[model samples]
Target: MQGFLKVFGHPNPKNPIGYGIDSVFPQLIADAQCLHIVAGRGFACTILIATTSKGAIYFGRLLLGLSNGFLVTFSNIYVSEVAPAYLRGVLVALVSPWVSMGAILGAAIDNATKTRVDKSCYQLPTACLYIVPVLLSVGLFFVPESPRYLLFQRYEAKAKQSLVRVRGELSNQ
Candidate 1:
């Protein structure tokens, strides 16, 4: 526990961002356990589509769960930050519909591809998860770390650079 906190905890041990990020450990653990149960979700799905019936569905569940988990945190952070206080309630209320819309779109694409439970279809949905890392990298490039975290850590240069990068100008500080 102590070892875990040291790695996941905040620099000052008091900030909300640190606290919230650290809390994600429990969630990440759940995600990892889910991955193990089904085994290489995407890989398994691909195998199932190509080979066996029993193997694919178990892994397909895992792949969907993993994909949803990856995007959920970002949606929380982004919508919370950018939504104005007056309309925050309304904005958040739209989350469910947006998720449904995404699912529909994914289903549309998959259906269009006409992939069967065979290898091709199995690879497609799970393979889509691989792009999450790329999407995350693109998103990360535009997000600045909280000033408090930077100040607590004494990483002024890195913090400032991040600020400039995200805000697109040093004057943003």
Candidate 2:
């Protein structure tokens, strides 16, 4: 598949830019996914905090669902792509467990806060929901692009650097 993409180009000779769609597409999708996740969650937070209209709240719920779907899909793709073969299965398997744990924790919070008469009962949980996206948005700055992604993009040096950033320097025997 990679070889096919590398070899093929648009049939038209007049085209200035052809081939390498595989490279650009993933990068574009990843950037868009990240942006969407952050913005969607931020919008959700606003909707939860300020909106009283049922329509707005419903729209926020829809956005949150879409954002959650994107998060899970992108996370699995990224984990599979970046993980070493030996650890890949284990790492992928752990995602669901973590998500379940989060659900349990969220339920506990909701139970604990349920008794409060004020808006804080629901607002507290909403605030908690905001934390993950905010932290993820900030943490993304320190995370290197997956080496496999860089390689797919034909960035050999960058791929090597990203690999080293993730895996540390390999010692020469």
Candidate 3:
């Protein structure tokens, strides 16, 4: 496994860096599962938006990157825990398609769909990268903040609200 992950942003033997980023993905996503998905999106979007701007995009992007990490880690586990027993499988199942769709979308947008006005292609799957996170975040708004998060946070009202919300949504014929 250790030998396998030496591929991400790996160092080019022909050029300078001693090693490469390698395929650290399995470890990368091991904890959060969605870490790669969200971070890739965040990173792509940050790169695109930052390139056009002049100053201090670095710190902002850094924060976004960190947020991407923390949020995805927190959320994936959060989702699994709060979901009802029967719905647990369904929730985890969602991770697969979302990750795939985001990657595909990023491929499409970054493929060459730059702004019509500028005619410049900033990145591959550019649209998809930016759009994926936004879409996921938006969908998140509809998702209940895990019962565990709320209960642990001691926001009783929210916990109850979450339960009622999911139940209502499910029971609606």
| lDDT of each residue in 38-57, candidate 1, tens digit only | 34444544554565566556
Candidate 2 lDDT, 108-161, residue by residue in tens: 999999999998898888888888898888887777788887986678988988
lDDT ranking from best to worst?
2, 3, 1
> Which residue runs does candidate 1 get wrong by more than 4 Å?
1-53, 115-118, 125-133, 146-173
Candidate 1 clashes between residue pairs 3 or more apart in a chain or in different chains = 49-118, 49-119, 50-119
- What overall lDDT, based on C-alpha atoms, would model 1 receive against the true structure? 0.55
| TM-score of each prediction | 0.47, 0.80, 0.48
Q: Which 10 residues in a row give candidate 1 its minimum summed lDDT? A: 15-24
Q: lDDT tens string, model 3, 1-173?
A: 22432544454575243443422343244434444456655764666554755453565466556766666566667677877889988987787797687667666666556555462555343433465567665674466555554665446777677777765544544
Which of 1 and 2 is ahead in TM-score?
Answer: 2
* Candidate that beats the other on lDDT, 1 or 3, i.e. the better one: 3
What lDDT would candidate 2 get against the real structure?
A: 0.80
For candidate 1, the TM-score is: 0.47
Q: Rank the candidates by TM-score, best first.
A: 2, 3, 1
